[model samples]
Target: MKRQRNRGRVTLASIAAMCAVAALPGQAHAADDPAPYAFDPEAATVRGTETNAEASELKSGSVYRSAIKPGQKLYYRLNLDDDTNAYVSAVAVPPSGGKVAYGDGITVSIRDVDDTQCGSEDAIFGSGEFARPIAAYAHRVIEKGNSTCREAGEYNVLIERKSNATSSPDEWDLELRYASEPAVKAADAQETEAPENWSSASPVPPSGGQKRSGGSSFYEATGLETGEWHDTIVPGQTRFYRVPVDWGQQIFATAALSNNPKSTEYLGNALSLSLDNPVQGHVDDTTLSYSGEPASVALDPLPPVDYRNRFASASDVSAMRFAGWYYLSVTLSPEVAKSYGDEAIQLRLKVNVRNDPKASPYEGAAGIFGVSDEDKDMAKSGQSAPQAAQSDTMKLVAAAGIGAGAVLVLGLGAWTLLARRRTAPAAVPAAAGGQQPPYGGPTRTW
Candidate 1:
């Protein structure tokens, strides 16, 4: 029979709920997902500057730096220093060579202009319609440009308030709204790739849907509380959640998470899992786990988790570049469960997460094993058992090495292409006599 497996679908709410389930009883395991918030915490830093047209020159005056990923939706808020009737337009330029990509055509008129309306508003702009005469705002998505900006480079947020008189104080402030990295593709897995191989199992024992033993409860609840969701999650911490299964019963597992509406949050990095017990598998190394511990497995580089359907693409899974609940279905063996129980077995729960503490909706790790409740209980205590010593540091080093190697490979490939182009043979021009020669230069003189 075709081996049944857990499928992955991404959802912010599901991620949160998975952590909550890990906290529930029957499996006294602690959530290890929240450790990042406690360790390296991040906060949103808002900075602003005011410019006057009299002193600000167009070249330098109309530019500022914004940290953003490609395809991220940004809402530009325009505030003109002077309220003279003017037309305002925004453009996003790549800082490398100041290459303009998007936002070039969007222009709004304070008055008289029929194209778009800004009306009698002093300042402020965006998507929401203005109740009273308010300022103007526009949203735009970043588009393809110089490759330099594709990775790390400067970008310009430009605003021009067109008025007969040039010295219109076109003060511009940007709200970097809805910024996110695009979902990395399988081909791009080596660089800035998302974890497509990683997938969440459907909530086992489907909620309110007649609970089946290890059926869908693994992903039923799809939300989580903010502030260190799991107390046990710590840096360099690794543990397993084993869900035992009956001889013929099928099961699945999924990661559960949620973000508070109060603030926007994102899940990133090499969130992964392993079968049985991986001894030396690096996130970048692709070692297909047919059986045995996770050893030197080369993982596909894919985009991090986002609130969406959680399924690693076909290529990603084929490349063995992800870690998710389905991994348990592949690695866990029924024989191993003899020590714990006799039913189903879900094994290998691992994740590396870091969150911005100030953001609402706590972040933590949770694993939902798809197995009969009785079998889950048998393996519960053992499942939560701490990973072998130094697993955290080792995993970190491995991940870093894989990243470094990928970058190196990409850089080398780029350099090789450049070198080949430079060394390629150049076309020879015909001689003045109109006859091509092996050595065209001064051939006649000889």
Candidate 2:
């Protein structure tokens, strides 16, 4: 029988609900088909930003879904401290089959309230980036005695469309994620630079996803079991996949993101690799500029997961501290945008899930908010005890507490080629809980 999964059609409310489900403890499934997928955290409907909002008015760390007309502009205000590192990610979800010639040009910039340009990037969706959505990301670190955007009280994140040829009249979704990373202290700075002890799991899981075509979306993540997985992705796109790791298992993943050899252009090493855990947001992430070469992300096995209080790590890797379906997300920077014309770039993943004695395994009966209640009780008693069997709700809650699926049909008009289901499956959902784990909610500066 075909495995049943969430048809991943999502709304912000659904995402919020899924985020709630993510907080619940896991329940066991009785050898049933795979539950339908989860909701999308980034798919929130946004308020108007066609005009710049004040720093106090603009929200941070949450995905704001909005749209602008051609030649229009959107502005967001940011307030920062000297010790805070600011991050801004702009996602442009293109319409199906829009004939974009020069690409829907996007210009994003950062400026202090006095209008000093701190940073700027022109992200043009080239005709070559036809299959998937694109994103524009910018970052700034407030430093001591910095000349530009110094002692930032408020800054502006500006986004503008440089062309109107390809986009539809309906406002396309413009989702932005703004965050502040804590700066390293002088005492700990040296220790922070220490290299990680990379380890590999023997006999990786023997499952892989189907070959990625030009049209895969983040929603329809190919399911990957532990093992070596392979696929190709377009530059200027981020792809998502799901791997179910139970309570006692440790997960490890590595990816080799390489440039297209046929192209003679300079491809910047703009490859981004990371992992998102079940409850916590991005746990670990790294960006390597690919100036036409290859780069890799080698993720180590997470500390054994327990549904209770989690041990903290980096934003991208810490979320995996729990046992559940973890998301392995890969996004390509557009340095290769000009080099590869509609050609998919290649990627290989080495995924390993192993049993760990140190971590609490999901094999036990689930408890409150994803914390097995029995574990909580054991912690209280200072001894392990027997618990009842897990119910069906545990399975439902573990799978983002989603309902069943329905047929999602595409319009048969001019965009038939773009509406192919053979394209990307719908994306899995995560409540990008503000910053990272050890924090239950998303870290928006509201």
Against the true structure, candidate 1 reaches a TM-score of 0.17
Local accuracy of candidate 2 as per-residue lDDT tens digits, 327-434: 566656544556665456677776776764343332333221133444333322222111111233346544543332212233223235544432322322333774
**What TM-score, computed on C-alpha atoms, does each candidate reach?**
0.17, 0.43
Query: Given candidate 2, what's the lDDT at residue 427?
Result: 23
lDDT of 1: 0.25
Q: For this target, which candidate reaches the highest lDDT against the unseen true structure? A: 2
Name the candidate that leads on TM-score.
2
Q: Indicate the residue-level lDDT of 345 in model 2.
A: 65
lDDT tens digits, residue span 1-446, model 1: 11111112223334544454444432222342211101001112233222222221212113222322232323223333221111222222112111121122122222211223322111221221111111122212122331221222212223333212222223222222211122333433233323334433322222221111111011111111111112111222222233332211222333222112322222221122322101011112111222222221222333322322112333223212222222121112122222322232222222222222111111222112122343334343222212211234346556655665565566667667866555442344565698665532333332
CA lDDT of each prediction against the hidden true structure: 0.25, 0.50
**All predictions: root-mean-square deviation over Cα?**
27.4, 22.9
